[model samples]
Target: MTSTILNPYLEGNFAPVPDEVSVGDLPVTGTLPRELNGRYLRVGPNPTGPAATDVNHHWFAAHGMVHGVRLRDGRAEWYRNRFVQGDAPNHSPNTNILAHGGRLLALVEGGRPPVSIAPDLNRMATWDCDGALRGGVTAHPKIDPASGELHSVTYLLRPGSEHLRYVVIDATGKATHTAELPVPGVPLVHDMALTDTRVVVLDLPVTLSMAAAARVASGTPESGGEFPMRWTEEHPSRVGVLPRGGTAEQLRWFDAPRCYVFHVLNAYDNPDGSITMDVCRYDTVFRDEYRGPADVLPALARWTIDPARGTVSEQIMSDHSVEWPRIGPELVGRPHRYGWFGGIGADGLHLSDDVNRVRGGSLEPGPLVKFDTTTGEISTHHFGIGRVTQEPAFVPRPGAEAEDDGWILSVVHDAATDHSELVVLDAADVEADPIARVHLPRRVPFGFHGNWIADNDIGE
Candidate 1:
């Protein structure tokens, strides 16, 4: 990998797009080294703070306006910009959450948005989201264009644990219906994903040894058995698909892998009203499986869904380990391609050998990758600077003929300084260099998930 000592003050384009295409060329710019780059901080796979929902990568309809907050100068700054717009709120929850169309779409069991933490254990809340409500529109809401309704999942804390309730809301943020969901072998539900006709809930099983269980009863640190030591085999992963209407019956259930984050990449509704979800299942045999925090298990196999019968089929297109799976727009009558930054072993943060052969670390930034379902071929576009990256969101060009063909918008992290930048890529071929890079004046504190909501769509 090419290594360059990062200049804390050097700003401008660290690496500019190639004037000419080459397999191993890195971009260079003369801009002053701005210390405000995002490379200085690190955000883990699990998003911290506030309960927001509906974080689908491709959910935003357009971008005339966007609203959210960024942590800068050790403080939270609320933002309302015309970059993307639609009916989205700026409130931050205590857990990880985001919504589309005024609905609490997907839910994660982590810290909420609008949070502040320091090295000395300083903690403070900047915003308040009413996540404790059970049957109403949750902290985040997801709207289903096909069904013309907002979908939400609510969790109710009860004796010993919490149970979930699904709620459907109208466009006006009014709850229309509510139903209980089933999650066996799991005591905690981290996040829930939705298909047009079905809902998939990923649950984490509680495995406490008798001793730890007793300690929990005695209000003491549960010693050692609070979590199971079973690394790979039969992880606490489980998936459930429930119909959207007409009895809201469960159509299928599949075992899923334990994900570092709760949200599913994406699920599609099949012609038969069944659902398919792409998930990363971690195997138990890998001795190094429990490397990081037990909650942050390394990702393994990728599986496709068959919600009609509640089953999952693994797709072996790429044997490489993948993380943060995302679905692109459909192409050639097929659903959008699936992709995630990949690696050979644990610590998906680093580039593996397969990526090395190309430009030797030029692809080290863990290129934005895509998997064509029809051809099973993979393509990657890299930012020479190796830094942590998140699932890139595809923003279709205005008046683009095909949804699959458009501009890809992403937040890239620079390894040298740990700063992040908003980069635009050509969707058709991710291998191409960025079309535009907007450097934030300050570090946009690292975050887990986000979406692009256009302004025209949201009601005034």
Candidate 2:
């Protein structure tokens, strides 16, 4: 008899919650901010009973479950968690959740469209932008702060496919325009970068591999080779800079080394007609083991691309390990002084062999780090041991003057209690004690992305 070894993603804080919960009047540990009248919603993988224990279950295949905390008038009003149901029972958008065009959406990569969720996190349905979205959208779409238009880059899910599109949706939730392009072997374009004048497309080395797919097709509890993508040596890692409304032929390309980027902190246009993109860059990911991301960790690096000279320069900003970087709300595709990242430390480098291990180790967050771009200064706030934090979203205070004048909100999980709480800290001073903490009724499994949706934006 062959033994079934569980995937590391199915254990510890990475595990899923069984029931959909709704609780009212969640207890607050400190005073709540009156200016904050919104909900913080986050989505992640939550597979049901048998799938969670299945040896072939990949972390990316689980269904999407969103956990939300509603706050209004200096009170923690309610807490709710709901699944983002897809067309089929098994398919769900388990990657990222955000508010766009006055609607809440759950998003995933690989050519899947967005799933809509109500404000109360009750129901979910596949949203096709009134039948205008001809194809799937990316998980990380950059919404222009000034114009409120959403920009995205979409790719076909299959390998060796040449289909890629640059989709633009207007402020009213309508598909405005799409620029189609033909490219080499289909790369897993996880995220995109947006500047004022153009959009940055990442055509990286990691592409859908038939070899990897064949291994996954065997359907066994093997030690490795469970994922469906691999790093392709033939596919040259490059950056394609496309003008906002320009077509495929107008794209300017710059070649780069073999690397992968799952997220972009921010990108902006420099004065010299070049682009500056700061990203969490991994040297190489999905090369060998297909279980999760790279066996190595990602470093904070800035890539300066000069289209005129056909050159790309790399600068390592911080050697310390960090992920889930966030800047101010209005700084998307714009230059900003400060950025926040969840400190990963060293424990996040690889998966542990012990599936039963828990209690504040192995990929759990360490501290909330603040990086000053102008001064090269770093500040961090450690939540002590056994307490880990998720992605920190920076919300500017009402009538805020300075760029950093705001609050940082994130879901913090405690290993001892197996519980989670929404912690709010001053963006200007994250090292200080939290200004408010909204204790949740249940545990929030380690999730991917979340955002604070204000009432006025949703027309509440």
Candidate 3:
């Protein structure tokens, strides 16, 4: 292993691709399903040049890019990658991408509002539900399939920012409800969860650093390039629960473990009035290192929150190192059977040795893992040592009934060739070979969350 203390985010598949290219007729090694006639869009940060050479140079904050592939009637039509154009302050939304309310949105946390991009992968303007949305949004919002509405719990990631916003937008691109819920401190509310009856807010331990904020304000040589958020014991880790469409006055806070959760797998309201949440739990992040993720990796855990008794019971479903968890698109705010995740570390998010020989890398991910939440069963698919797999998104088969009846799509990077491919694996048989692989001409850097936007869903 390379023992050098290099920023792992800037090397290997985590490295950014220069310039944008549009290529047609990408080669395919297997047959493309005729029913799959939509664009598979994956996005991540791709710095225009080199990132800042400072301690604050983090993977979370960088220029955004969206790589897209179009499929029509089982034929690979085209592939394109474009830099998401944004010059406004706090508008660099380089985290996640999805289609909602008949529009495409590139998302980020904090005061940066979601930016609207065209279906062709070009930059547009900062969107706000046609003025129904009054403020910023979250990258990880849940879309209700039954009602065709979007529910989000967003917060301002600024120094001394002390409140969270809960916004609900309807199917017609209009905000129906919005409220500001108060929190104790400037916690890093990266992700949130939802159920049919209530919204789950993760008021965890990671909060803004006033010292780091001073560094940012000064712009001095001593404090150049610093990410402002860090883990803090001063801020208690609490899970705030509130009824759907309710105000901050109704929010009931429940105490939780001193942990951080970047992504929530799925949540549901039990018949007994308790909320069940499955999440990727991290022991701590941004503790020792201020740049990006380090220390202990995340494990799959389930938290049972009982508002009636004001208690939460935490259980580890598995201790495997993993991140970027996903369920069936329609299963948001509902119970789910299967969850797909991207693996990390040797087992996941742990130091390989006492010498600490490695940092985080795109090559460190182990497999595309599938967990049966009901039976405590696990299955995984690896693309070998050098070929790293990012998040696996599940696209359900058209008119499918079974929850696991879908194709798991992911972007896999091959280090030997320095290129990426969109691999389609059968969710029923995840350990099997890819059902289809669409080859790209160049490498796609390992980044963040994405989804398969069916033409029908977006009215293409």
Q: How displaced is residue 195 in candidate 2, in Å?
A: 0.7
Q: Which candidate's TM-score is highest?
A: 3
Candidate 3 ranges beyond 4 A from true positions: 1-3, 50-56, 87-90, 132-134, 221-224, 346-363
Model 3 per-residue lDDT tens digits across residues 1-460: 8565466677777778888999999899898888888899888887654363443367776778898989888888889998886547545678899988888888887777788888877656788776654367888988888898888888786766779989999887789998889986778888888898888999999988888888878977666456788899788888988888889999989899889889999999999999999998878888876666665657789999998899999998875667889999889999898999987743334333331423442225657888899998888887776777869999989899999998998988887899989999998889999999999989888788788988876755
Candidate 1 per-residue C-alpha lDDT over 343-426 given as tens digits, one digit per residue, 9 for 90 to 100: 322223322334333221121224566666556666776576454355566545566676456665556666666545656567
In angstroms, give how far residue 419 of model 2 lies from its true place: 0.3
List where candidate 2 sits over 4 angstroms from the true fold: 1-6, 214-225, 346-362
Model 3: weakest 10-residue lDDT segment is 349-358
- lDDT head-to-head 1 vs 2, winner: 2
Task: Give the C-alpha lDDT of model 2.
Answer: 0.81
Give Cα distance to truth, residue 273, candidate 3, Å.
0.7
Cα-based lDDT for every prediction: 0.40, 0.81, 0.81
Q: How far is candidate 1 from the true structure (C-alpha RMSD, Å)?
A: 11.8
TM-score of each: 0.59, 0.93, 0.95
Error of 2 at 278 (Å): 0.4
